[model samples]
Target: MSTLEIRDLHVSVETNDGPKPILRGVDLTVNSGETHAIMGPNGSGKSTLAYSIAGHPKYEVTSGSVTLDGEDVLAMSVDERARAGLFLAMQYPVEVPGVTVSNFLRTAKTAIDGKAPALRQWVGDVKTAMEDLRMDPEFAERNVNEGFSGGEKKRHEILQMELLKPKFAVLDETDSGLDVDALRVVSEGVNRVKGNSDIGVLLITHYTRILRYIHPDHVHVFIDGRVAEQGGPELAERLEESGYDRYLTARA
Candidate 1:
């Protein structure tokens, strides 16, 4: 089984003043077939942690290491880390003006699989994934996220995840800005992939609504860049009732 390990990770961002600390000694792990939910308020460095794992150049890993299936992920490039089976579905997916969804998916698939999926099979796979997400086939002809609604962008991200079939997925606030129906569609897409023994999910969110659909194996409360609390579904229920204030106060 595959594993994604985050070991006492410390991250910072370059600034005119020097470096600004973001993630402070955050540690977590997700194994194949498991779903781990990270919930916290804004500016808790949850997205920074996700970007760090995906090897985004903007976030600098000041200390600690990230590994995938025992391989040193910290030393790899963004594309390399992706090819090694790590996927990050961003909260704000960028708009590629001229890149059609089909082309983008094909390129990503080729990069991850080290081969080109046959034209007929590629088309079929994309169509199936789009249909599973309730997206129209014409979406493949449209440019990625250009003029699309927030919900559409989120659904597109899940579609990519389904097609790519990564070993571990870090979904960074995917439920944000989505309507109830859109949320259900995205959650269903995620659930469809969960049954695969080779996939593990790190679902980061600020609300418990998504968790009601995903049902995490473990839930972690991240406050001030560190994991302040850890529990099962009960923790999510508590957060739904009391919010993050109690945990933040205890951490303070």
Candidate 2:
């Protein structure tokens, strides 16, 4: 089984003042075929952890190591990390003007696989994935996220996860801005990807709503840039009722 391990990951972001510490000695591990939900209040460093693991330049790893199946992940470039089976669904997907969704997906697939996918087969796969995600067939022709709504952007993110078939997917607040129906649809898309492959999922969110549709095998509560508590699905249920008040108080 493939494993993604983060050991004492200390990360910081450069600000006007200087390097601002974000993640302080964070540690976590995810294995293929498992789903881990990270829940916490705002500014708890959830997104920083996600970006750091994805090799985002803004977050610098001051100390610690991230490894995927024994390979050093912190040393890899952003695109290199993708080819190594890592994917990040950004909290706010950026628009790619002039690049149609169809073209972008195919190009990304080609890059990851190191060769062009068979045109016929790739077309069929894209069609099926779109249908499964309840996306209109015409969506392929639209520029990526240019005129899409928040829900559409989130769906597009999951669509990439479905098509690219990464080994591990870090979804940062995918549930944000999604209405009930959109949320269900997006969660189902994520579940489809998980059910089809042995992909590991690290879902970061502030609420238990998405967990209702895509149940996590483990739940981690983040407070002040560290994992304050972790448990099974039951922990999520507890968070739903108690919120992060206890963790906040403890941090204080």
Candidate 3:
């Protein structure tokens, strides 16, 4: 079984004022087939944790150990991380101006799988995944995330998760900018992956709405870059009712 572990993670970033600390000390573990939701207020370092795990160069790991099944994750490059079965659905997926979606997916798949996928089966798989996401078949020909709506871009992210089938997925604010219907679709796609694969999920979001569609096995409240509290789904219910005033007050 695959597991992702974050131990005493401390991360910082370069700002106008020089290296400012973001994640103070985060320690969390996600086992196979588990979904963990990280809920927090803005600037609480939720996104920092996600980006740090994905090895974004913008964030510096001051002191930490991030490992996947005892393998050193911090030592791997971005592509190496992908090939090693870690996935990050970015908060804002970038637009690849000239590359078509079809080409991009194939390339990514090839890079991760260590060889090119057979064209016929690969095309069929892409088509089926797009259809399942309710995307237009012609969208395969469009440039990645170019001229697409917010929902479409989010859907494309899920499409990647479904296709790539990573061991652990870090989704950063994926529910943002999605309408109710779009949220349901995206959540369903996530659930589909969870049910079909033994992958772990680290879902980072400020709101609990998406939790209704994709049930999290564990809920964590992130405050000032550290996990303040963790519990079962009931914690999310409490969060929905009381919001984060208590945590903010305590932090202040």
Estimate the lDDT of model 1: 0.92
Worst 10 residues of 2 by lDDT: 243-252
Q: How far out, in Å, is residue 91 in model 3?
A: 0.6
Predicted candidate 1 versus true structure: per-residue lDDT over 1-252, tens digit per residue: 888898999999998999999999988988999999999999998999999999888899989989888899999988999999999999899999999998999999998999999999888888888988999889899999999999999999999999999999999999999999999999999999887546999999999999879999999989989999998989999999999888777877
Model 2 per-residue lDDT tens digits across residues 40-73: 9999999999999998888899999999999999
lDDT, residue 191, candidate 1 = 95
Q: Kindly provide the TM-score of model 1 when superposed on the true structure, using C-alpha atoms.
A: 0.97
What is the model-wide C-alpha lDDT for candidate 3? 0.94
* Pairs of residues at least 3 apart in sequence or in different chains that clash in candidate 3: none
Per-residue lDDT of model 3, residues 116-201, tens digit only: 99999988989888988899999999999999999999999999999988999999999999999999999989999999999999
TM-score of each model, in listed order: 0.97, 0.99, 0.99
Q: lDDT scores for all predictions?
A: 0.92, 0.95, 0.94
- How far does residue 241 in candidate 1 sit from its true spot (Å)? 0.9
